[model samples]
Target: MEFHSNSTVFHCDVVGSDAHTTVLLQEAVDALAVKPGGTYVDGTFGRGGHSRLILERLEKTGRLIALDRDPAALAVAQAIDDRRFSVSHNSFSKIQEVLGQFHVDRVDGILLDLGVSSPQLEDASRGFSFRLDGLLDMRMDMSQGQTAAEWLASASEAHLEEVLRNYGEERFAKQIARAIVAARARQPMVTTHQLATLVATIVHARGRENKQNPATRTFQAIRIYLNQELENLSLALPQCVQMLNPGGRLVVISFHSLEDRIVKRFMRQLASSDGMPRKLPLRANEVRLLSRQTLRLVGKAIRPGANEVESNPRARSAVMRVAERINRT
Candidate 1:
């Protein structure tokens, strides 16, 4: 169904004090070079931290479309009364279809604040954090798919091992997977603390260098696997490129190396022009650029400054990368 900017509504966060500070806020927004009357997208609205700012920068006619799979995130978006802003409750991977529904053929820029948001992690009911003792339900979109607990119940040992290694990049993935299988056999792994304790028992990393909890990687791996985060990101990149208007920018903030690598490779591959068909030599003016070479790499991968990281620990691992669409005249 088509949702117009004026017709769409969002719920704003009332108690924003505890909200996770949006990392690299100015840098990511500036990368867009947002024009007053241009259209933009916040691919991961997360509590509308970036979306609210984007709306502020836009002119009265300028439009901003924000998307989030989490109902809680979308609820946070419902409080904005501006006619220029619209929020959609769906995965960013469905960019093409969502844009189509809005009658938006292309946008001037797109921002993706990827990974778990603070509210999702802090809210015990959502089951996104290892620090909380909630059910193992890590579905980004609670309305659909298998919960982390459900997946753990039936997933094969090999599959679980692969997810931990591939998504979390945990060195002790094999031992952790074995531990999970063994523990589940004794009793259905239900609460966050139960799983965390079990994983900690198997993973014996010693010393003061363990800055993060032992079960952090295991929970992350399960969340990513259950929600298909990497797969969704891979699917969304090409669509993001395609959705950009000529000269439009794509800004992405990835919290982990795995997600960052995928964005980097996707942008690099699209920016290169190595696969064009060979033809009779022609003048530079006569030669045409490959359609996929529509993007040009922006500045180097950006990281949060020490001050920002100190204020918001969540910013510590965030990495932002940007690219711009080259006019294909």
Candidate 2:
């Protein structure tokens, strides 16, 4: 229940060569405006790519706290021997709770890189990619919950269609779900390739796209639903804003439109005073106190540069947004 920093990480990518390349590395770190002696949080530690960078910007007096849900990331975090840094094994949605456990009241900044990491895609056993043949297990934390295979085995055709449509935005969700139901009656939905092939069959016949894998949206849909990624993000944003010190930054890097939509709306809502009640003809100071903004939108959404996208194609979809906490004095 009380895991130390060295124990794990938040949902994020891998480190080292052949692992995840941290997206917006310089831009994200720079947005944080790291103060050598201030405290900060890397909400999604992944493989410590961002965490490591944050630590480098910190002095011995400064502190960095990190979180990740994947145990694999926990192992990577263990290698960090710095005394000023600590990590936790938990979802980013639990940021407030984790900070409490760490005895930290507020932080100067928080950075969240949302979406699948390259290590997850490359690891066949994790079942994140259709290109890789492995067990159909896409649980972000393999130890915690149901795998994609298990869900597919038990989920009804209608429910499967809903997930595909809502999460993946697949146009032919209904047909694909029907095919899955038929296929499962004959054999178990046990492997990534099996499901990928099945989905591709349906997609190829009706919803084919040449540039992308036919089953790409299907895989993404299942993973998002099963992992409850969007829900976690929704829960985490308010907490991130609440925990920031005045002028502290909240940086989020989202990989898909859905995730970005949630982030954008949340940031915009808090940054605008119109979201508050304004009926009372109260005094200026009183109105200010009652309807003060909690966040101020920073620069425009940042995307990976052309060179970065070319070198790491996965970074192409990334969109980073920044918001700074407002001092309500």
Candidate 3:
């Protein structure tokens, strides 16, 4: 089946026995330019795919700190008994704090692989998959925060429409929001199937030709919003930059356009020269001096190959961007 054509169909079949095939795994680690004795941070630490590879490249003196907001992921990280590696149950947004606790101020490289992990998606109780009949909870850290069901139960129709439009980019956001409100009036939406059914019914009525599930966008938007995924990414990017040593690398693997856009824009903004008036009376050398940038874009954005995507449809939308810190006087 052409699972990549539809987000729902793609995710539904990969179940209990399946493992997350880290997209662009070697590419991301190689971009880090790992030094055997250097310090590195795996900011997302989703199942230790990248972390284990990093450890392999690290020498006895090399250190790796892995962080994740999800407790389940942290539990898996705890099994690593390496003296050079440590796991923290914290979001990457707190990278600075995590470093402080370890008495470290800078790292040689930092990698953040964004989006939901395979374990989270396949575990029906997490409510990350639309195909799963589970509670509507979508928190990356299930220990805290409001579940999707709780948020949807009280969000205004206008807010719902806005989330669907802006976060999900759903063309039928208004219709879906209206349908959700109407349906909720009859009863609370407490399960994944209920919400998915509601959205599919509304989208199906529109007679769209796309094979993608109608609920895909809505589910994505809710998960993003509830987890403050974009907000956390925004917060973490600057910290990653600040925590890097001169020549340090920042590698980000984003799974969707929204995440990729933010990563692209942030890296570009840092790489760009300071904006000066075109008519400034300074000499060319002065202009160049004033335009010193903090970051250097390492390379072009990368995508998974057809073979990788064929084996793991979830990698279809993956994009990896790399940047290096420029030494400042």
Choose the strongest candidate by TM-score: 2
- Write the residue-wise lDDT of candidate 1 on 253-300 in tens digits: 999988999999998987887455566574474355564467899989
lDDT score for candidate 2 against the true structure: 0.88
- Candidate 3 wrongly placed segments (more than 4 Å): 1-18, 274-292
CA lDDT of each prediction against the hidden true structure: 0.84, 0.88, 0.87
Evaluated at residue 250, the lDDT of candidate 1 is 98
Clashing pairs in 1: 10-77, 10-78, 10-79, 11-76, 11-77, 11-78, 11-79, 12-79
Clash pairs, candidate 3, are: none
**Per-model tally of clashing residue pairs:** 8, 6, 0
Which 10 residues in a row give candidate 1 its minimum summed lDDT? 1-10
Q: Write the per-residue lDDT of candidate 3 for residues 48-116, one digit (tens) a residue.
A: 899989999999999998888887776667667677887667888888888877678889999999999
lDDT of 2 by residue, 1-329 (tens): 12464333334333433366998999999999999999999988888788888889999899998889888877787667777877787899999999988889999999999998889899999999999999999999998799999999999999999999999999999999999999999999999999999989998888466888899899999999999999999999999988999999999999999999999999988887634466666667767754667898999999999999999999999999999998643
User: Top model by lDDT, which number?
Assistant: 2
Clashes of 1: 8
